[model samples]
Target: MTERVCVGAIAGAFGVRGEVRLKSFTSQPNDIAAYAPLYTEDGSRSFTVRLTRPVTGGLGARLSGVETREQAEALKGVTLWADRDKLPALPDDEFYHADLIGLSVHDTGGALLGKVRAIYDHGAGDILEIHGPGRRRVLLLPFTRAFVPTVDLAAGRIVADPPDEQE
Candidate 1:
C-alpha cells in the first residue's frame, strides 16, 4: 500500500478568480477539504484546500498559493494526494483502492488469475479490472462478496469466483 492516496483532482479554473473546479474522489465529496495539505504525486508541492461552493460537475475550491486564474488553470488535471495516516480507517469489509491495486488474484481452486489493474465505480457498484499473462483482453469483475469471496491484504491476493467468460 502507498503512503499517499489520491483524494481529488483540479479540473481547471472555476472562474476568473484563483478558485479551481475540484473533482473529489472521497466517499463524501466535501470531506476532501478536511484532509488538508494535500500533495502532488511526486511530493514536490502541497496545498490547503478551501471549498467555495458546489459546482456543476464538482466543487469549486481555492488552493493555497494559487492566487491567479492562470495558476489554477495550470493545475488542471493534477491529482491531489493525501497521506494515508490523515484519512479515516475503514472497517474490515472496506478496502482502499490503492491497497487493492496490484494485488494478485486467484480462483477458489488456487489457479492464478491476474493482478488488479484498476477499480471503477459506475453507479451500480465498484468493478475490478484484472489483467494477466496470455489474456487477450482485461477481465472486468464486479467487486461483490459473491464473486470476490476473500481479500487477504496481508497475503496480497484475492480469491474470486468470477462468472464464466463469454469468449
Candidate 2:
C-alpha cells in the first residue's frame, strides 16, 4: 500500500481570486480540508486547503501560496494526496482503493485471474478493473462480496467468483 492516498483535485480557478474549484474524493467531501498540507503526486509541492463555499461541480477552496487566478488555474487537474496516517481507519469490510490496486486475483479453484488495475465508483457502487496476461480486454467486476469473496491484503491476493462471460 502507498503511504499517500489521493484525497482531492484542483478542477480550475473558481473565480477571479486565487480560490480554486476543488473536486474532493473523500467519503465526506468537506473532510478534505481537515487533511491539510496535501501534497502533489511527486511530493515536490504541498498546499494548505481552506474551503470557501460549495461550487457547481465541487467546492470552492483557497490553496496556500496560490494568490492569483493564474496560480490557481495553473494547478488545475493536480491531484492532492494526503498521508495515509492522516486518514481514518476503516472497518474490516471496507478497503482503501490504494490498498486494493495491484493485488493478484484468483478464482475459488485457484486459477489465476488477473491483478487489480483500478477501482471506480460511479455513484452506485465500486467496480474493480482487472487485467492479466493473455487477456485481450480488461475485466470489469462489481466489487461486491458475492463476486469478490475474499481479499487477503497480507497475502496480496483476491478470490473472485465472476459471472460467466457470453462467448
Candidate 3:
C-alpha cells in the first residue's frame, strides 16, 4: 500500500495574495483542509491548504510558502497527498482509488483477465481501465455495482461481471 494518497491538486493562482485554484478529490470536498500539511508526491515539498472560498472550476485556497501569483502558478498541477491513516475510514463498499491501481482482475470462473491499469471518472461514473493479458490491448470496464461485484482488497483482486457478457 502507498504511504500517501493524492487528495487534491493546485490548479493555478486564484488571487494576487498567494491564493490558488484547488481541485479537491475528497468525498467531502470542504474537508480537504482537515488533512493539513499535504505533501508532494516526490516528497520534495509540502503545503498547508486553507480554504479561501469557492470558485468556478474548483475551490479557492491559500497554500503555505506561496506568497505571490507567480509562486502559486508555479504550483499548478502539483498534487497534494496525505498519509493514509489521516483519511477517514470507509464503509463496506467504498474504496480509495490509490488502493485499486495494481490489484489483479478476474472473472467469475476464476479466469485471469489482467491487472487494473487505471480508474477514471468522466462525469457519468467511474471507469476501470484494465491492461490486457500479454499483447492484448487495454479495455475499459465500467466500475459499477452491476459490473464489478466484488473488490477484496485483502485478497488483492476484483471480481468483474461484464454487463454485455450477461446475455
Candidate 4:
C-alpha cells in the first residue's frame, strides 16, 4: 500500500440518527472532512465526512454509507487515514508524526541514545519517546530546540542534548 497519514479518528456514535463523534488530528480540526474519502487503517472501508456540529471532545459528523446509530457505534476508535499526497505540505519546522518514528537519536557528543518509538502531543508540546536497544525504559525528550538541537531528516537521525542525571 502507498503511504498514508492518520488525520482523524471516530470517537463513536454521537446521536441516534447515525451521526458520529470524530476527533481530528489536523491543525484545523474541521479540515479533516475536507480531505474527502478517508480510508480505514487497513483500507477495508472509505468514508466521506460531513461535519454537522461541534460536540464535547470532538465534532459530530456523518459518514457516507453509515445510516444508523448501530453502524456508527461499531466504528468506534477507528483511525481515519488519508493519502500523503492529498494532504498539504508542512513547513520546514513542522513534521508529521509518521516521519519522526523509527529515526535514530544521538547525543550532542555523538553517543547513541535511542530510536524514536513514538511522539505525543498533550497540548503543551510534542514529546519524543525514545528507547535504546535492550532497554525497557524510555526517555521522553521534549521536541524543543533547547533539548533537540538538530533534526536531520535526510540522515534519519536527531541530535539531542539530554538533561543531567535525575535528582
**Best-matching candidate per lDDT:** 1
Candidates' lDDT values, in order? 0.95, 0.94, 0.88, 0.92
Could you tell me every candidate's TM-score relative to the true structure? 0.97, 0.97, 0.94, 0.94
Model 2 bad stretches (over 4 Å): none
Residue range 83-132, candidate 4, lDDT tens digits:
89889998888888988899999999999989999999999999999999
Per-candidate total of colliding backbone pairs: 0, 0, 0, 0
RMSD of each: 0.8, 0.8, 2.1, 1.7
For candidate 3, write residues 1-167 as lDDT tens digits. Answer: 78889999988998798899999999888889998789988989988878989999999998888999999888899999998888998998989999999999988888887889899988898999888567355768999888899999999999997654321
Model 1 alpha-carbon drift over 4 Å, by segment: none
Position 38, candidate 2: lDDT? 100
Give the better candidate number (1 or 2) by lDDT: 1
lDDT of 3: 0.88
Q: Model 2: per-residue lDDT, tens digit, 32-128?
A: 9999889999999999988999999999999999999999999999999999999999999999999999999998999998999999999999999
